[model samples]
Each structure stands twice: as structure tokens, then as C-alpha cells.
Target: MPYPPDVERWRELVSAYFAPEDVNKALWVILHESGGNSNAIGDSGSSLGLFQLNINGLGAGLSEQTRFTPSENIRQAAIHVATTNNWTPWGEGALFRGEPFGSLGNKPYPGDKKNEFAEDTVAIPGQPAPPVINLEDIDEEGFELFSPSGENFEGQFDGYTSNLEFAEKRILNLVLEHNLSFDPNQGYGKTTTDELGDPVFTLHEEANMWSEVFFRSEQGLERISALRDSGLTTAGRKSAEAFLDTSILENAAGQKNFDDFRSRIDALAAVENIPIQRATDIASM
Candidate 1:
């Protein structure tokens, strides 16, 4: 079968639905094996889709009816890759092992040694490629951590403002209101100290709360910038900066506000034909 001219589109669709970085290699291998065509449903009975997924284990969230659709096929294939090999850029080495030249079969007209390759010889390109399969990465133990499903102290503050000061106030108030033992002398710094005269907010507890605050709010970046301006410690600034630059914030309807913010920034930069650097400097204040 001739390869699809729209292979790149198919690749993009699949990558979007699954792992973008590793999809190229997976597509390369699958193309080598199945000629980029979804196997006929009847040919392998239980097998379906581009990667020949068994209907019973379609964990990729692909419906059997859409098995042949290029996008669906790629999505399922990518999910299969993730599940079977733990396809992450950081764990590729452990996920694949080199095999003998002919181990993957020579049916694809295996010829020159340089050109001919084994199934596992292919590699995923990108920084910090998926890690080799590690037991630590897999959660095989049946033990499940206690996760609250209902609204509680943590739930009430989820997606709350990213400002550390706000977070501190909330923690302090919660502790006092609940009569929890936390020290007040420790202060509401990034590190949560039991100095609040409370056991509820220990050092580890403080760290986790700060993490949650940063993860949930856009103000985290501004807070970090403010901290830097005030000559405060930069211990957690790296993550806050990165999150501000790359993460997207959304409204109740899921409309992204980052683009709007960026546009406003750009407009401020363009005002009076001010240079972007100068505008950014002014806006930072």
C-alpha cells in the first residue's frame, strides 16, 4: 500500500492526541510494519487499527468503530505505546532494547545493514527523552493514597490565587479557625514551618501548600517577581517564572486569558512606539 500523502497531518493528529515527541518514531515503526494502513478488522479477528489493537484492550479510549480512522488509529497507537512501554521522553532507554538485525523480520525488504534496522533500534528525538522503564515510574502496588473527593480545607482553596501572601493568610486562618496547633512566629514564607505553633503546617506541609498555590494561580509569577524586586530569596523563583511564561490560565468557560494578557502587553509595548524591552520594564512595575 502506498503511504498516505497526508502522513504528516496524520502524524500531527496522532501526536496531539498522544505523545508528540515520540509519535514520529512510533509512526516510523508502525509504517514499517503495517505500511501505514489500519489492519482489516477481519484479517486478525481480534486485532484492529493501525497498530493492530485487540478490541478487549482498547485502553487508548478509541472506539472500535473508529479504529480505521487515521486520527483515531494514531491516538490508540500512541496510547498503546504509552501503556506498553511507558513512552516518556525521560524513559526511552529503558523502554527499548537493541535486538539482532533480523529479529523484527526482513519482510520490509531488509537489505543494506546501514539502512536495515531492528524494531528497537528506532529512537525518539527531543531533550530528556523518555526514561528507561523504571519500577519507580510504575504504580504496581495496590496502596492508594487518601485523596479527598469532597470539598474540604484543601478543596476550598483549590485554584485559589497564586499569591503567597494570600496563601499564607488562608493557612493561618484555617489553622486558627479550626484550632489547629501551628506556630505564628515562623511567618508565611515559602517554607511552611510548624513555628505557627501548629502541627498542621510543618515544613513539608508548607512546601506542599506553596506548590499547590503556584500550580493553581497565575499570580505566582507576579509574586515571584515582586519577591525578586524586594531582594527576597530566589529559591522557588525558577518554577514560578517558568509557569508564568509557559502555563495558560483560563476563565470559567475555559477561555484562555493568556493570549489576551499577551495582547495587552503587546499593546502597552506598542504605545508611543516604545521598544518592547522598555515596555516590559515599565509593565513589570
Candidate 2:
């Protein structure tokens, strides 16, 4: 596999799927690993493709065949980065993280290495990614968090922690309510959907809404962003990043991993005193 000839596409994806800092860092990581070549293979035969990811460490759902596609390679790399802080698995060190880039692997004490990434990092390989719910299967005519019909998922909103999935869904629904929402005109912001609607956002805007609503606090956002920046994803981080975590192009356990993350969110939200509904700004953005 050659580096994605269309580096910009991958850049946009990274920007869309990851927090602000992560977008640049992920690209920098590839800059070091494959020189951004999607087709680049590692000197070590086991590694292949853009990020030079080893098939062995790729975890569940992905296989050798995925190497040929630049999109999957970048996506998997971002996931791996989100799961674990630092680019160590990709053969880079915490050097670009303001530490020395070289000799990172030779640091000697593997266990002693402090991941030191912010708390928001999210990555759990044992569990599969959330199931990629087919947007086509969902009703587009109108949006509803609850309804007389069970198909509308009336129970998805179980408050801050348990309703993680619902939050993501609602963000999408609200964004789709073009008649009801407007854009963030804030001039600058993180995430890909910064400029969605005049009042409400769509696409990446939906994701930004999820990121904020789940965390429910500035500290929460930073901690989660730190986690994302460092490349680690815990249950809480996953909960916060769920919007970005579930990409349409990838296969997800969909609802499978949602519970674990929600549980984590439950515990943390209790401790943090985060409200079930953080704010309605996303809807009115």
C-alpha cells in the first residue's frame, strides 16, 4: 500500500474523527512512521501499510486485507492511538510529545513508562468498536428519543451515563432538525463539525455535540481531550468519543461496547456531578 495519494482526505478524516490536537499529532505520527505513505510497509515484515501497523496488534475485526486501503489504515491507526497514549505501538516514542523522539523504544523499563497522556484517551481493544448502526435503517423523516413504538428507542436516554448512545443519536437528530437549529458562529472550535448549520450543526457538528454533552464539564473535556491526545481510550473516554468512534466506514459492535463505556460514564459522572443533559447549546449552535 502506498501512502494515501489523497493525504488531504485522510487529514480531513482525522480532523473529523479526532479532537483538534489529535488531528495534527496523528498526521505527524504518520509523517514519522510511513512518511504518510499509505502503501509504506515496515522494515519488519510483520508491519504493513500507512501506519506500518502490525497485523498482530491490530486486535479484533481487522485483518491483513485491510492493509491495502489507506482509509482503514489511517482509521485503525487513529483508533490505536486513541486507545493507547503515545505512538509507541507504531514504533515512535513520546519524543514528538516534547520528549526525545529517538531511543524511545530503548527506554528499558516498559512498565516504568508513564503513559502520562491526559485522562480522556480512549482505546479498548478486547471489546469491539460499537456496532455501526446503519443510518439508512434509522428513520430520517423525523427524530425522536422516545416514542410509543419501541423501534424509536424510548429507553436510550437513561440520563448522563447510561444514555451515552442516546446522546450521540440525539445530537445527530438535533443536527438534522435544520428548521429548529442554527450554527456556532463562534469563529473557531475543535472537531470537524464546527460550522454546521446557521443554528444547529450536522455531521461532525453532531460529533462535537456528543463530545461536549457526555463530558459535561470543561475539566472533563480537557481530561478526555488529554486522553484522546495521548492515544488512550478508557470507558469514559470512549463514552465521550463515541460520536467519533463510530464511523460509518468501519465495522462496530455498535451497541455491544456502548454499555461498558456507559458504565464508566455512570461512575465518573456521579463523581464529577455531571448532569444528564449538559446543555442545549448544541441544538441551538
Candidate 3:
């Protein structure tokens, strides 16, 4: 069977940058680091490309364009690995310390869990296969550490407005009214309504995915800009700044958790000016 196009591309690049003996190992690392997505931007936009390198620190001297390009990104990663003589720059490397390669084959080394990526490899047959790391441990922890949630709204709007409370409320309402919630099941953002025809605000999972999808589109940016220009009491300006910073797009998992969206509607009912029942009715509507 053929390799995934992106995976095959990375394999060739890795082989070019690494020694014949190390090509398999390099391929293993790239698989875990990026799952072969050259455009994969993670670590809240601080990292880019196949290696998810933080060029500002360990990736020092790499230009923005170089970091974003797959070939250049892989080349720089190979250089970084050669210079350090280890994999400390990457999460899996740093987390595992000395055992940067994880388990090598069908068996788990000591405490290491069995890695399925090892099975996923396209072996050359007769040659020693590369060790595919068990990244589940890192993934669970990383998701918790990096997943964006509504709870971390602190400083999100700094320099945009001082009215955090009103701005947040207005933003939530706008998100609901504009049907910005993305449904992956349909590959688009759409308004869902209950039996009464009241709009159903996005669920936490849907909202999180939508944050990533919506912020990547032109419409999302225009909306953010419009909101920002609307007023200090609204979140458009702050959101726009976040949009520009890629905080709302590439790094949305850090700021767009939808639980807050759900709670805010209930809280909005408590506002003395809005009357609880009316607020509830508005949410249902």
C-alpha cells in the first residue's frame, strides 16, 4: 500500500536531511510531531512546521518564512537535532528525557506503553525498523495543558477595552446570533434550534472546533473587526486583536472553550436590567 501523501513527502525530506542509518528514526519523530501536516501550527502559534519548533528559543535565527515552509522546516529541524545531539527541543524528547526514541518495536521498553505508530510504519523489510514513540501520554497531558477554554478569558482583551464583562457578554450573544458555531458533522457553521425553534448555542465540543475553523476564515476575521469597531463595551476589538495574533485561529484551543458560552447565558439572566425570565427566553430564542 502507498503511504499518505504528506507522510511520504516527509519521509523523503527526512531521508535527505538525516544519515542513512537515522532516516527511519527521523521519520518516526516527524510522524509524532506533526502527523505529517506541514501546515500544522501548534503550541499556541509559538511552534510551526513538522517539528513544532519554537524557533524563537531553540529555533533561534530561523525566519518566519523558513519555519512555515515544510522543506525548510524539516531542514532546520535536522540541523537543530544535529547541533543538540538529542531531541530535547521537542515535547516527546523533553518529556521522555534520555529515551527520546520511546519503544523500538513490538515490545514496550520497561514502563513505556506499546506504540501503535510502530505498526503504522512502512518498513523496508529485513532492515531494523525505527522506534515509534507512544505519544498518548504526551497527548493527554498536552491537551489538558494547551486546550483553550473559556475560563482563561483573563487578559484576552487587554489593550482593546476595559469593559471585560459587557464585552464578553456581547461577544457571546453575537456568536449565537450570527450562527458562528461550526458543526464538524456538516463541515460548516450552522444554527441549530430546539423544538420551540429557539436557537441552540454551540455545545462545548462543537464550539471548540468551530473556534479553530471559524477563526481561520475571512468571515470570522471580518466579524471580529466589526465587533471591535462597534464599541468598548463589546469584544470585537479585543477579538480582532486576538484574530491578528492567531490566538483565535491557530491557537484557539487556548481561548475558545464553549463552557463559558453556556454559563454566560444563564448569568445574563441575572443582570438586573435584563430580568431573569426575559434573559432565559432570549437564550431559548
Candidate 4:
């Protein structure tokens, strides 16, 4: 039989009402309970199709007859589940997630394991939380990853390692020292309709790029500090500062910044009568 017209509509409605993370899981729950058969009736005879809705003793949504409507069933169920994080609405199926139900969807409510962890670790009393991260975004070796295929995922993780790893270390230190949120389940990774709690990228590589920017900027600031500390002539320090000040750090990065920073180091080295390598090395510190 053709699927009920209500399926997509209900999914749309659920995505709008709940977090994106809930929509897929809710759909999978429907898939398991009804096999996407809108007319499916449980052996218990009370539960209806899609979300196994029992309009009879259910909430103030529809009647038993209307419960068979796929979209209507999903809408009611999603709204009900939105009120609480309880998956007992799924019965024993909640305990055993596998095929037919698809991947175990994340908990939708604030109290679910993910949200609880986010709250414990991510929530900032006076500020917004940073992008949420998942255990899936990392590997057993503690490397941030974008794909699940180990090192063989898309793009060159190893190629980006030196810069990527350095950036990762800096950002991670920032997050931990500042008590920022690294919670994997921030009610993210859902379809477009769901509420994105904190900022998160869709790909691991993109996240790495974001971290790289911060690391580079920190390095820029260090260079400025170095010029100030070096015992160079006044003109030399001013030249270095003018060449590698905050503007260099804030502007769009390119080869120009590198050229300018290197030039400034050279000038400082010449003025101080030190080897350019030694002067550059001191600034790097």
C-alpha cells in the first residue's frame, strides 16, 4: 500500500517542535514500531501505526481511528516525548536499539545523558557554550576526526596534523582552562529544522580549520611580545611592532604576514647584532 501522506508532514512538524537530534531518532522509533506502514496495528491492538500511537488513552491529540494516520501519529508522539526525555514510551525497544529502528538516536530532552553531560560541562552561566563535540569526532588515539573510517577518512588528516594538532592542543587547553563545553551531545547534528544549541560544524575538517585560526592568532601576539622584550634600538623595536602588530594578527592571513613577520625578525636581528636564526628562535618562544 502507498505510504500515508502524513509521514513527511509529521516529521516536519516534529523537527520544528523538538531539537534536530530528536527527529531522526523519533523517525527510527516509528520505523521499528510500524515498518513505515501507516496502517500497521500492533498485536496489542491498542497501538497504532508510525509511532505506535494509542490515541485512546494518549494525550489530547486524536482518537483511535485517527491514530493510524502516520503523520498525525508521529506529531503527537514527538510532542509527548518533547515534554520528557523518557524513552519508556518506546517500551523494551528503547533498551535494545538495532536495525529496523536504525542507529540509536540521541536523547531529546535536557535531562538525557548527553544533555546532562553538556549541562555539567558546557553550560556557561553568563555566556553561551562553544560548539559541542562528540566522542565520534575523535578516535581511540585521542585525535579529532571528521570521518569514521579511521585514518582513511576524507581529506588528509595526517597532512594537516602539524598545524591541526597544534591548534587542537591550544583550543583544548582553552576549553579546559576556561571551563568551556566539549559535550558531544548538545542536541546537534539533526536536520535543518532542529534547534542547534551551540555552534557546531558539519564536518571534522571544518572544525579543525576553525581551531587553526585561533592558534595562529596566539602566535602573532607572541611575536609582538617578543619584540618588546628584545634589547634592540628604539627604531628597531618600533619597526618590528609596526610590521608585526595586532593588525597582522587580525587581518586575513596569507603569505604577506609571513613575509612581514620574517622581515621584522631580520631587522631586530640586525639591530641587536645577533644571528637571524637566534633572533627568530627567541621570538618563536
Q: TM-score for every candidate vs. truth?
A: 0.28, 0.35, 0.32, 0.28
- Candidate 1 ranges with C-alpha deviation above 4 Å: 1-9, 56-63, 83-285
Top candidate on lDDT is 3
Winner by lDDT between candidate 4 and candidate 2 = 2
Candidate 3: residue pairs that collide: 55-59, 148-253, 148-254, 227-236, 228-236, 228-237
User: Positional deviation of 107 in candidate 4, in angstroms?
Assistant: 21
Q: Which tens-of-lDDT digit does each residue in 1-285 have in candidate 3?
A: 334555555554455455455555566666666666655566456566566665565556665545555545765666556556565565444324123544321111112221111212223334432223222232232121111111122222221232233334544555456555434333224567899999865554333333333233323334335443545222433444345445434323233444444455567656646666655654443
Ranking under lDDT, best-scoring first? 3, 2, 4, 1
195-264 in candidate 4: lDDT tens per residue? 6566443433333344434334345344434443543334444455456545543433221233443344
Q: Give me candidate 3's TM-score against the actual structure.
A: 0.32
lDDT value for model 2: 0.43
Question: 217-255, model 2: which lDDT tens digit per residue?
Answer: 222233335445644434544654564445311322222
